[model samples]
Target: MNKMYKVLATASILALAAMPVAANAQQLPAQAVQKGNANKQTDVKNVPATWGQITNFVHDKSDKFITVTGRGLAPTDQDEIVLAITPKTKFIDAKGKTVPLQKIIDGHKTVKAFYSPNITKSIPARGTALTLVVQDQSFSAIDGKVTEVRDGRILVKGTDVYDKHDEEIWLHFADKATIIDQNRKTIAAGDIKEGMSVRAFYGPAVAMSLPPQSGTNYVIVNTNMEDVNPGEVNELTAGTAGVITDQKDGQITVIGQPLEKGGVNYVVLSIDDKTQIVDEDGNKLTKDALKTSGHVEATYGAVMTLMYPAHTHADKIVVKKAESVKIEGTVMPSDRTSKDQVYVNVGSDDSTANDVILNISKETTIIPALGGDTALRAGTKIVAFHSPVMTKSLPGITSAEVVIVTSDKDAVQPK
Candidate 1:
């Protein structure tokens, strides 16, 4: 094998903010009709009406927030009804049409209801419909009951509602009330629309399940797609000729060139097909030769299955190409000596790259064949994928999926 080794990055892109649009506004009827009159209609009295309805249920999570738009109403004048309805509940719309409370929200405009974690809130109960008189100029109307007040949130449940204007109705709330609403909200099925924002409590249940927390956080790249190309490694003529210390099935261990002046032995393995390599005689070597010493390359990609030992140790490397991709970057010292493990510096300046400590060993090499390799350096210009590394306090995200860098002709360095 030859003594020419450079760090090839597998580029990929990741954007967690890529979420589904919430809801579209409800379309108004093409032909405008009279509200409660067929022929020459008489004006209805505008007296302050006190309508009542039930709150079926409320649901929520910590990370996601709900948005509630004000409907020109206040918390006091509006009557808050508490009621929990089941799939069998019946609802009546303004047209006196009977419908299931769970089938609304069909083509109705709905908006997100934002809430402060400190402020616990209640939403219409699931499968239930509620109605209240519109009063004041506030967009929101909350019925404050003094029975079970905790964290300043109201709870309601049971019963049906009456006197709700379809176009003028916009009630959005989350279910993470600091205090659970033993009483739920109620609703009439005919009034629900596809565009209406809802929680676990609303009629047309629009709830998405969340994946479990897997503790382990690492960079993943599909071996089939393009590799993550970090910037270029300047000072191409500064390092000593590298020597192969160990080589095995698709794995290489090289220790010779000093990363710094007197750095420790640096040994790593290229597991996938995206990892590339070349020998001292300018002979192309398979990624398997990485265990021996040579040139190599890597690419980036979107979502992939990441398997690690004990959810902490980087024992194996696996990349599954799906759709999105980005470049990943990490600055680890070659001084640290460890088998199938390396410390990465999250402080790297690669915009499209994500920095993460990586470990690749048995579980990775055990796989068949995937990804390739091409000669790359710390700063070698290359495309990459940028994803997010979630933490307890903050979130870490990359700029781009893959950082486009120079080609192979521009990546190779002097011996």
Candidate 2:
């Protein structure tokens, strides 16, 4: 059985290599595509090759050998192959961030491997993988007021978004980092001051110290405030992830869980013309869309009024897609009439009671619980995992992640 499977897998890879458009596969990861056959036992021919997205990574009961199965040899339906994982296999994420082999084995995440052109024995059936890469397209952001800026580095004092603890961090800018305004316009990093609210997107690398030292890939400096009150600055600089409760007349009420409180907390944002607004995909949003779009990630200053609920000026707002919801049931997929949004029924039977309209982003991930593409259609059983906030409409609005489409309809689906 193993020999037959190996033969089929080899043919699949060769067929993909012979395709007219195999060059596109090189974009899978930054350093994932490399060269060198190195030795006689490793080459399938003189020409080099690459392959990935292996899902099935299993070890023998006695822990001797392991097998890995993956699809889309070149992002094609005909591409399917398996690789043997030995101790020599190195595991990492798309950004070349090293990941543990045990984590890949335990989680239901996509595993991509690249064989350095020399893993074959005469034929291309299989060989020891050179490097294995895991799935990681998400980012971590830190929002706070700039405490200090010097020597091409910015120090921020704010709540850690990951742990929600009061903390401070020194951020070093990447060589190619972009320092922009809410409008994403280029600006001088030196213009940032101590009291201005700012946000920075960084990587997993961090130095262990009193206030962790790290670096940022991009930074957004909020010039909204010149100075923040010490007592109120914590609330001003703290980031909030929530759902839009009400929006009208340049005011947006977002109800999200507070860092200190477990229950939902509400904050009404006073929007001004200069307020930086954008969508989850970082697309600039108009004033109208900023209000109506229910889910958001926002940063603000102290409340301006003494009203019952109180209000504050939202320095920066991201009308984000709702995250964290396990949607399950038969799908009653609405047709793609226009390009706005799609409403798919995951409600009871065929009712719209539990159905939701989704604003899908290009960064969204869709895969089967068991792997490969599961065709989506009317009444297709599926389970979707998303995050943080959810709209309160009669049905609601949301975004999807890892949607397990049950039907074996199409071999190829959108990434």
Candidate 3:
């Protein structure tokens, strides 16, 4: 019996060795197992992150989600996915500062998201977002002529080299939008005017309006006007008409028609003893006759300052008499033959139907209550001075001698 037991035990041991050695029995050491387990945990923690542009936001009472584009698990995977936002999710900006989720959405910023490897088996996989890093704001530049300068916006008409097309864009100035001269010196939005060349940096998102619109980041006014050759003689015959914007201590600044065709919208005229100040009838007048908001025609010499609104000695200045008719009303929307004109509703409301079409020519003076010339657009309240002799039509058409912007309600409001 003892011999049988020994044989049986040997047989058992032989069978165990001959049979598959239950893999675990020949397993690696505890340290190796621990290392393996640690590696797996590390893998779970180090799942590859996917980056994409935030296309849209989805929010409700109990949940928040964001749609991300240009990201996928594989190279051939769909480019968009829906990411769930949890309380533990963190939002970081390019500056490494923590920001609210709304800020990223409002900025329409791109982001990199860290999420779990597990995702829904949907066309565009849905996953829980662990963290999101907001990318820096990317800016695009548009350089062109300023077609219009409204309360807090400007229309730029020029060629877009990237798009390879001519575009007119209305750029809305943000509260922090910087306006600088060619020298990088800070300037005011009012300093910008139609007909001047400018370069503006703005965001990628553009509003689909009549002329595309975008929020401007910064603007650099091209103060470098084409220099006149010394050899070329300037015909002292250049003439301009507009309203006197500034007059003090024998110096007058006029905002009106370009000194020459296709020139700047303003000019600085230096008055001296030889300068002739007169009225339309050629009656002599003192230098005091040149007043702010007074419509006038000016003739200047060829020699002028290099700066825009070129400064020069005035050979003659004709201050026209004040318009006899005065109309106070809100600027209304109407079909216009030119961008230089606006339709004014004669009363406090549009119900009056008494629309007066004010043609804004180079001679019209636009005066903002805050002190500066601005282009007139719809929704502005103004007091327009014009001649009583208007076109005999349902809506009288006349030239606007002076336009006073009484309300700045349409002005830009910072976000």
Candidate 4:
């Protein structure tokens, strides 16, 4: 029975190789199939040839093999063919250049393999590879901001031609991967930083994972921040000041007052080696300084995910000092003792309610919700950063350091 099965399998492989182009037209590239057939006729001389995408490659000290699927065959595990590589196997690249085996495996390019006619009856038949030709060596480009940089890898968040949505991809740099700056000068991988704009060139083969993984070939850093006009928003700039709600897994969750009436109120800031974490006194600190319920001002890249509580790569994070506290609530009607004084209700429930009066002095920084200076009024939502110490009066009062108007209903247009 085994001998009969081998004969049948051999006959099936031969018939499929000789079959018309229409049978495997979609699976194999036209140029690859034509060249494969020509090689069978001239070089191999009656040896059967099969072409497909390299699904798996195994290379050790002296053992090397590749699994492929195509040539009128289904892509199922049972239909894959394992081709063993030996010293006699010739490797040819897309440009007809004679290349090494490592180059073909590194690119993970689709290939046409000429093999011996004798076949085994194993689930996935095995054979000796004669000549392998790389079908495509075309490179793909990804333009985005670097979110993370690790040992020999960098995570980029951006879009490609095939995917319009935001994609976070981890690019594994090949040993020979070239890194260059804007002037085209070669640089080390250490120069790549979080929030920096870069374009990476990689191969088509991608490993299936949550965030897809690919082998990168070349990288170009776009480092020209001085050219941007002051106050102009671009792909390289984004800022938010809010309270830290969570800090874990190298990310900080900041819950700030909404930018507009119904805008986003939270942002996830991803930190990397280049992210500067400091205190308001200009003293440098580690990421551990970002504690929950603490106020912070973060500057990150404009490239961010569109999901709720958007995520971005942070460039700098300024942690508010321990002496300060942030209060967020609705403004309440109260008779002010002076023009710089305002009152706010500090809690939703009656049991926790506290009427706090904020003294906005000339030294206070008032930022309006809609981008310009606007006076705070009743029923307005505000986030005020002030000293924790307050006067022990009916309505607790303190000097406001920074008051952000978060409501638009009472916001007046700036002149």
Residue-level lDDT of model 2, residues 1-415, one tens digit each, is 0001111232232232122211123333333323565443422322222332333444666332234432223322112233555577677877778888777666644555555332311111234456666755322345688888877777788754433466577777665555767555678777777788886655344444445555564566768666646776545464456656557887886655443311114467788987888987888987777643256777765433322133678777887665356566655545532253445666446476777765655534343322223345444566555453568985676665435455534323346
Question: Which one wins by lDDT: 2 or 3?
Answer: 3
Per-residue alpha-carbon lDDT of candidate 1 for residues 1-415, written as tens digits (9 for 90 to 100)? 1111122222200111121211112212123345765785544322211122222223334221111222111112112222222333234454435543334322122211111111101111011222221211111122211122123211221111221212111122222211111122333322233322222122122112111000101101111222234532222212222333345565443322333422222323334555334544546565443432232222212111111100111122222222222333443344442455433334446432334433333211111001113223333433332323332321232222222223334333447
Which lDDT values do the candidates have, in the order given? Answer: 0.25, 0.52, 0.62, 0.62
Listed in order, each prediction's TM-score against the native is: 0.15, 0.30, 0.32, 0.32
| Models sorted by TM-score, best on top | 4, 3, 2, 1
lDDT of 4 by residue, 53-93 (tens): 55567777867887664331222212245677778877886
lDDT of 1 at 28: 20
Alpha carbon lDDT at 273, candidate 2:
81
lDDT for model 3: 0.62
Clashing pairs in 3: none
For model 1 the local lDDT of residue 361 reads 35
lDDT of 2: 0.52
Candidate 1, position 368, lDDT: 8
Worst 10 residues of 2 by lDDT: 1-10
Cα deviation at 181, candidate 3, in Å, is 24
lDDT of 1: 0.25
Q: Distance (Å) between predicted and true CA of 82, model 1?
A: 42
RMSD of 3: 27.2
